[model samples]
Target: MEQDLWSVEFTSLADAIRSGRVTSTELTELMLARIAAFDGRLHSYIAVAPDLARAAARAADAEIAQGHWRGPLHGVPMAVKDVFYTKDIRTGFGSSIYDDFEAPYESTATARLRAAGAVMLGKLTATEGVYAGYHPSITEPVNPFGDEHWTGNSSSGSGVAVTSGLAYGTLGTDTGGSIRLPSACCGLTGIKPTWGRVSRHGVFPLAESLDHVGPMARSARDAAALLGAIAGADPDDPTAASVPVHDYLAQIDAGIAGVTIGIDRDFIAAKATPEVAASIETVIPILEQLGARFVPATFPETREILYGWHTECSVEAALAHRATFPGRRAEYGERLSALLDHGAQVTAFELAEAQRARRAFNGAVAAMFAPIDLFLVPALPVAGPTLAHMATLGPDPDGILAVGPFNAPFDICGYPTITVPCGANGAGIPIAFQLAGKPFSEALLCRAAHAWQGVTDWHRRRPEL
Candidate 1:
């Protein structure tokens, strides 16, 4: 059977539009139809903007017909995590409290995509306030691969939408592991850019200092396309770095020849499940065939840094929700309430000390990258857990702690990282490994990931659903 347009990468979809092989309206309608048919099982979308998407697609088609192609993403259909504020659209933040809240203006990330002529499919489901876990009151998105498997939190719907062909790509935030976790579990490529690489304006705050906005897509090149559209300094977000955005697609196909990929074999052997460890081990030879080399490297002791991450994130989250929590506290799920209550108790001095430790940890990790171009690690220590298993852990579970050992350190260190599907386990669940680079090294990361995808078909494998 011919693959659906929704399963193709955004780059391919854009090409089809420009070549007059398809209209943006046709593509948008196909995606909407897919959502109508299958999202019932995936539960990936919180809401579908049929009228808005159709209107936008018509506008895009008119522009392309007039030879006014905006760029690669022009007319491509995509969705965003519900945490992003979309003007006149219900920006639920995956919480019942804000379930009816619609933003007056668009988020910088979504606005940039819209400006690029991308058609919005709708808002994807997200954790409450894009925090540690799924919102208790909201319906959790099941993995497209299997309902028993985990979809990965916070950005769960974003992952499922991309993996199951509901959307070509979607935007997800990563304060800890939100982006990469879902990518790993759902078998997609996800980039968590260096801190401030993308604007956070109009995004619900999880942990302001640690928060990052990035893209999840079918391939590294697709992710690069999305990154190019959304990345850049935003005046509205004072924290958005003034760093010049690179043409991420420029070097994406450039093979990683002579590139030194650092691997901490001991770390993987000790921390990852045997299957995940073996899967990452398989990537070494494949990349070596593409002219890349590997060397031994060590990661900084993550225990202290992990603790500091919890402290800083909890305190910041508590402050972000202070006015609402304990005031209308019953409206929040028990786990989120507990987290807020815990954050309320963190002393001022403790927060100060955590910041100090965070800097030290960043410095230590930065030093590791000095001798290597990129460091590789498993995206998750184990295969994704089932929703039932996660349910037993309760709401407000320490998601960063539970899933972030391999993921959170980069957020703390503020380095760019990308997760690519390496392989799958016996049960058909996806397994992935991450590649971390120096700050603002998104181009290099994409290049390396693209090279791996070229040699392996892991990323191309989709769920039967």
Candidate 2:
């Protein structure tokens, strides 16, 4: 195995372990060391379970030596956002209220990954209750690309860990752009699988209807491997879709020949900054060269989606935190506290109207996808906004709305969307675009993204540590 194991792609690491080129213990130790050396500055982890990871790695090695390889993830070390329940490990939902709390059982996603023979590295950092900001006591993960850039929302740690090579891959939950935002900002590939596509049984909720659990990785194929391990129906979660899971990597190299990718040039131009818009424009010619077809597809009316997303997310979040919120309001952060307060005050009629609008938007999106296999857009309006800029947008409704146009609509529709690194700005911060598909179209998204990655080296570029 190479000495620079941290920079290797997830699939390559798994292959090395499977072929006896490296042992799980070796990989685990290297990752643990890297986390120790780098995480102090990055703050990408909430807790690291080195003992547990070693035990799991040893077991995996013993099994593989006996010719019992479980699958692609066998003996591979990975981590999850702290919101997922990990038995015997502190599962802080990034809140001071749960500072000393540990889960009695494991989340379905973690259990499934363990069952697939993957080694658990530890828990990654998450925003307070997976909301807009970190709890007062928690340190926000810094963007590895530049300390000044915003790390995105709740899944910032997941993005930081993978981009910084602290973990091979990670799980990130998306409600409104949590996964895609960080992936875009950090220059990683992320999948926001359709709602219910992955079981969320033991994961803390931001918004029940809007929340989605998915994988963040350096490449699309790596994401497919992670997604395959944790996806499918779970008896513990009735909301987990009963649909049969697709072998995401089976057709990953099939090429995008003749695949219709809908492009609303005006839509992207109107919503994106010049840097972002130009970067997205460059991606079209590359995809076209790979035999993909593009058509001028108009985006659906989206002004209502921003407001509906706020209403629906607020109400559901209020329900999720009902047991401890008002009683322990002081323990919460300002952003989450305000969210809960607004949610508490929303009248039934307002929530109902929000739902109505969401449904109409979903229908419009479905109709728009009827003629195209995928819809293309910038992952965020700006290439990469600075933390200073994001701070000002905290209380500005218009500013808040500016960033949601490319993100919230898909969450509202429960559609599958993937973000791939397309280009970068002058300062070398990442710029990316999104490809969204109809529900359960994750395989298509992965295939398209993988094809893009194969032809470009944008995803392979790393930040200097």
Candidate 3:
């Protein structure tokens, strides 16, 4: 095995493993070794299932030797956010209260990946209850690009593991900006698939209605492959869309020629920081050069919906935790506790107003997408903020609340959005832009992102872990 094999993308790794040039055991062991060597500092995983991974790898190798090639994910090693239940594994939903809890069955998404022959590297870390901050007892994953920089939560572990070569790809759940924020912060390609496009059954939730299960990887094609393996309607999750799952890998090469990309320049300029604005401006021409046509578009008024996001998410989160919270509230972290406390105080009238606003926001977003196949926007207003700055977000909520303008609306509307590295800041931290489309339009978004990645080396760059 090549010494740098652990650093390869999911697509390449899959191809190699399927071709028998790289055995699953070899790849799995290599990843385990890397985690042992580096996770002390990175803390990208909540638990390391070495025995389970090795057993699965051996089984995959045996099956492949017998001519049973599963698919693109065969013999590939990957991990998922701790929120996704892994049968019999300590599925800590980033909360100490459930640190010893193990599910009898796995999440539909992770189960699908396992059936597709992907090895379980383990459960990656996430924020407490899959909300904004880590549990006081849980160590946060350090940004591989810069130690002091934030690795966007609550999928911080997903971003760090992939970018730092600990995992080729990982499943990330996004309610707000969990997936996209980490992808932007860590310079990776992440897809927050249309809500219901992927099943959430058996997965722990922070905000049930808003939560989305998706993949994060080093490239668009790799993300597409992961998405394909895990997507499709599941009986266990009635909410999982009954629509057909595209062969995203096959659709990824369709290219973006003649595709209409909507750009709300005034919206971006007003919402994004100078660094982010400049980086997004730079990505526009690159996409144009690839034959994507850009057109002027204006975003709908967002303040009402954005403000209401807190109320809705908090209420839902409070509900999701109703079984154990308050009764076991002592075990909960301060941030998550505060969220629940806030939710408990919300009046029935307030919740009704928030839901009504969400409906309006969803309709407005749908209308906005009618003229364009995709809407291009900044993934984050500020790129890779320091850990110290992120700490302040707790006290001065607006700093973090401002992020909803770029990311949360899509979650609110259940639109398919992909975030890809476009440029980097002076300190070499990455800046990314999101391409959001109508529901279940992941194929097109992947095509556009994959095309840009082919012409640009941003996705190929890795941190020196």
TM-score of each: 0.97, 0.98, 0.98
lDDT of 3 by residue, 254-339 (tens): 88999999999899889888888888889889999999999998888888887788888888988999999889988888888888
- Compute the lDDT for candidate 3: 0.88
Candidate 2 residue pairs that clash = none
Clash list (residue pairs), candidate 1: none
Task: Compose the digit string of candidate 1's lDDT tens values, residues 415-436.
Answer: 9999999878777888898999
* Global fold similarity of model 1 (TM-score): 0.97
Instruction: Output the worst ten-in-a-row residue range by lDDT, candidate 1.
Output: 391-400
- Whole-model lDDT values for every prediction: 0.87, 0.89, 0.88
- Runs of candidate 3 with Cα error greater than 4 angstroms are 1-3, 394-399
Clashes of each: 0, 0, 0
